[model samples]
Structures are given as C-alpha cells and as structure tokens.
Target: MIVPSSNLTMETELPRMLRAREEAEPGDRFVFHSARARMQHVTPEQLLAMNQQATRAAAELADGRPDVVATACLVAIMAQGPGYHCTAEDDITGALRAEGCSAPVVSSAGALLSGIAALSARKVAILTPYMKPLTKAVADYIEDAGIEVVDAVSLEVPDNLAVARLDPADLREHHRKLDLARADALVLSACVQMPSLPAIQPVEDEVGIPVLSAATATAFRILTELGLPPRVPGVGRLLSGVEEPAA
Candidate 1:
C-alpha cells in the first residue's frame, strides 16, 4: 500500500478495513507505504509533478515485492482528465516493473467509479472535504462514468491532515442534510482523507439508500482485482452484491 504524504487517512482507514477482514481469517496480514504528495491546495501541475516522485518512493517500498500497489489519492489523478487513471496506473506499474517489481496498481478515483458502476448506480449524492474546485473535479469524474451526481456538498477543508481528522459523525450529520430523493446511492464521503468508513452503513440505513466511501470503494476494487471475495459484512450492499457477495 502506497499513499500520498499529505493523505493522513488512507494509511489508517485502509488497514482498518483490511484488519477487520483479517479478524475473520487471522492468517491475512496488511501493511502500507507512503510517498510525498503536494496536497496543500494542490494544483493540477503540482499533482502531476508529484506522481513521478511518488512512484519512485513506492518502488523503494516494494523492495519486499508486494503483490499490488494502490495510488491512494483520487483527485490528483482525476484532475488530469477523464480516463486518466488508466494512464496513471500504467505509469505506476511501469515504474514498479522498471524496478523489477510487478504488481497491479489501483487508484482510489478509478476504484470509486468502478465500485459505483459495479452496483449499477445511476444517480448519486456526494460529500467531500475538498474546496469547491476540487469537489467539482470529483463530480465531473463521476459524471464521466455515466453516473449522475444529483446533489453534492463540500466541507471546505483545505489542509490535508485536517481533512483526515474530520469526524465521521459530523459527516453523517452533514449527509443527513443532503437531498437524496433522486439519488440512487449516496457517496457518503468522496475523499479518502475524510473519515467515512465508520459511518457508511448507518447512513445508508437511515437514508434508505446505499452509501459508499472512498476507502470502502477502494477496498472493493482491490479485493476484486486480487481474485478474492469482496464481501465484508456491515459496509453496505455494494460489498455484498444484490445477487451474491463478491466472491
């Protein structure tokens, strides 16, 4: 697991989900590696410039030959353009391969869109800890996936670490205030740095709709790519598909 230096949540949230799974099967173990990212009011240029350095740092961490690498920042890659995750994933994979390390690469932005599509979500409500500009980028990325972002809100937090420290309970409250009548699903939290995993299912139940977070969707994507079952009870129907769990 490799993440942006400014990202303070993925390092903790991802492992929380993995560990919850490991508790069911103690044999599984998880670890992480982080690389620097210019996340403080990150500009498009700054994000692209950081990718090469981030990839290099990830290669150093792959000295142990991990099975896969995940690019944890969603907007950083999405801000580049539509379908940019394909190129970003390729670049990261190529970097790792050049270092004699072969691993599938997953981007949170790509994974979030994939997760939404997998569930056949057509209309969604979104919440983000980003400023209006970055949040629009995320909404556009989702719209590029053919999903309608019917409603959206941003907490307006600019500091990366501060975004990570946002209370999940507060997020749920903010979610409660959103209009969900036309939304088929609620993107309870869009940014990985926003604390959301702990609040998704409850919010879903209360809103009577499927709720998803960046971390939860990323987990779903990683497990799917790993040829493993994605179901982990308590997250939402996305993990446990309408027909069957993601085995």
Candidate 2:
C-alpha cells in the first residue's frame, strides 16, 4: 500500500485491518510508501498539483514492485469532480507502467462510494476530521454518486497531525450528535486520519445502522478486487458482510 505523504492514518489503520483479516496467511501482508502532499488548505488546484508529484513518488516506490498500490487521499481526488477516481487510478497505473511496474491502483474515495453502494445505502450521515471546506467536498462527492448526504459534521481540525491525534471516543461522540433520523446508513467517519476503525461496530450497535470509515471501505474494495474474502471481523458489519460485500 502506497499512500500520500500527508496521510497519517493509512499507515496505522490499514495495517491493523490487514492483520485482523481472519483468512489472511502469513505471507499475505501489507507494505506502504508515502508520497508528498499538503494536508492544509486542500483545494482542487492544489490537489491536482500535488498529485503530479505524488504519482512520481509512487513511481519511485513502484520500483519495489508492490502487488497493488492505494492512493489514500479521498477528498483530494474527489475535489476534482465526480468520477475522478477512474482517471486518477488510470494515471497512477500509467506512471507505474512507465517505471516498469505493473500494479493495480485504487483510491480511497472510489472505495468509499463502492462500499456504500454495495450496502445498497441511499441516505447517509457523515463525520469527518477535516474542516468545513474539505468535509463539504467529501459530502458533495458522495451526493454525486446519487446517495443523499442526509447530514454531516466536521471536526474543523486544520492540522493534519491534530486530526490524527483525535481520540476515537470523541469521533464516536460527534457521530452520535449527527442527525441520523432519515439516514439509511452512517458514514460513521470518513477521513482516514480520524481513527474510526476502533469505533465502527460500537457506533453501529448504538445507532442501529451500518457504519463505515475511509480505511475500512478502502480495505474492503482492495480485498474484493484481489479476489479475497472481504471479512475483517471487529471492523464493522460492512466488512463482515452484514449488509453486503462488494461485487
């Protein structure tokens, strides 16, 4: 797994998910590489500019020849517009190919949408560790997928490190504050930096609906694409096939 340099959560959470995979064998492990990007003031122009350099960094990591690489920034790519993950994945794949590496590419944003769709959820409430602007971008991206963003709350944390430092308990508290009355599902937490995996099942049990985070969704998508069982017990019902696994 290769991630953007500014990413602080994937390194920790993704490994935990992979390690917790009940069916994973010893050799089935995950490794990560980070590419530079700015987490503060994430604009579409800035994100695109950062992507050019980030992909180059990924190309360097591709030299080691990972079986697959995941672009971990969700809102950064989604800020470009709807369906941008396809283009982003293509670009990264092309860059790897140019560097004599053939690795499948996946994006966090693409995985989140696919995960939600797989659950057949149409209305959702979201909790994000980003500021209002970035959170809005994420909400818009999901809404573009034909899913209704029933409600959303942003922690307004501007510092990337600060976002990563947030307690999962606090995130669950904020998630509990969101208006989920009409929501068919809850995006429990969307940012990878927010440390959501630990709170997923508990929050779902309390809210009586499915819950997901960027990390869990990405893991689900990557595992499904790899033709492996998507079950990662204790993460959430989403990965355990309580709702539905990705097709």
Candidate 3:
C-alpha cells in the first residue's frame, strides 16, 4: 500500500478486515507492506505533494513482489480533479514496470468508485474527514462519474494525523446527518485514514443502506485483482461478497 506519512488508520483498519478474512479462509495468509508519501495535512497543495511521491512508493512496494499493490488516500487523488485515479494508477504502473514488477495496481480513489458501482448504487451520500472544499472536490469527482452525491458531510479535519485520531464510533452519528433518503448507498468514510471500519456494519443496519469506506473498497479491489473472492467478514457490503446487503 502507498500511504501518507501521517496516515495511521490504513495499516490498522485494513489489517483488521484482512485478519477477519483469515477466520473464513484459513488457508489464505496475508502480509502487509507500505511506502509513505510525505503529508501532514489534508489540503489540496499538501495532497498534491503527497501524490507526487506515489510513483516512488509504488516502486518500493513493487520491490516486495507482492501479488497486488494499492494506494490508501482516496481524496488525495480525487482532489486532483475528476478521473485522476486513472492517471494515478497509470503512473504507478509505469514506476512498477520500470522496476520489473508486474503486480496489479488498485488506486483507492478508483476502488471506491468501483465498490459503489458493484453494489449498483447510483445515488449516494458520503462522509469525509477533509474540509468542506476538499469534500466538494470528492463529491464533484463522483458526480462526474455519473453518480449522484445527494449529501456530503465534511468533518473539517485538516491535520492528517488528527483525522486518524477521529473515533470510528462517532461515524455512527455523523452518517445520520446525510440526506440518506435520496441515496442508494452511504460512503461512511470517503477518506481511508478516517477509521470507519468499526461503524460500517452498524450504520448500514440502522440506515438500511449499503455502507462502505475507502479502506474496505480498496481491500475489495485488492482481493479481486489477485483473482480471489472479494469476501471479507464484517467490514461492509462491498467486501461481504453479497449482492448489496441492503437489498
């Protein structure tokens, strides 16, 4: 995984879900590797700078010869403008290829889009740890992809580490602020570093809608890219190998 220097939750939450996967698939073992991109805040300038280091990170992660590679910061790519995830993935692929690494790449930005579509969600509401402007960028990026963003709530945390420190339990409350009545799905955590793993299932059950976070979406993409079933226990609908649990 390629993660921001200050991101603390991706390593924690991603492994938590993958470890749970071990319960269901005891034969499948898992290991984690990451390369950090320097970042301390969630601002556009900082995100852009953090993104610039992804290719290098990709090369480093590829050297591990992992089956698949993924990026953890979603809005970092989204804030780059709509559809930047493709470009980011392409760039990372280029770097890995240069290192003679052929691992499949999954960008969290693209994975979030894919996960939502896999659930057949056309309209959605999202919660982000970024400021309102960055949150708007995320919503616009999704909207440009033909998905409707019925509501978006920004937690307004600028410090990247602070975003990681946010309590996942609080997401149960934050999600209620969205106009979920018009949404087919709910993105509990638009930012991977925001730590929504614990709240995802609970919120989905209460709201009677599909719930997913950037981390879970990335996990789904990673497993699928490896030609494995996307099923992972207890993270949310996208990784549950279900055809939209809300339905």
How large is the C-alpha RMSD of every model relative to the true structure? 2.4, 2.4, 2.4
lDDT of 3 at 19: 88
lDDT of 2: 0.79
Which candidate has the highest TM-score of all?
3
The CA lDDT at 114 in model 3 is 89
Candidate 3, residue 108: CA error in Å? 0.6
Candidate 3 has which clashing residue pairs, if any? none
lDDT for each residue of candidate 3 in 92-183, tens digit (9 for 90 to 100):
98999999999988999999998998899999999998889989999999999999999999999889888888999999898878888899
Candidate 1 lDDT, 1-247, residue by residue in tens: 6566777788887877778777765766766555655555556666677665666766775687877788888878778878888888887888788888877888898888877877778999999888888889989988987899999998888877788778888876898667899998998889877888778888888888788888888888887777667766678777763322243
Where model 3 places Cα greater than 4 Å from the true spot, the runs are 243-247
TM-score per candidate = 0.91, 0.90, 0.96
On the 0 to 100 scale, the lDDT of residue 114 in model 1 is 77
Ranking by TM-score: 3, 1, 2
lDDT of 2 at 122: 94
lDDT of each: 0.79, 0.79, 0.89
Which one wins by TM-score: 2 or 3?
3
Clashes of each: 0, 1, 0
Q: Which is better, 1 or 2, measured by lDDT?
A: 1
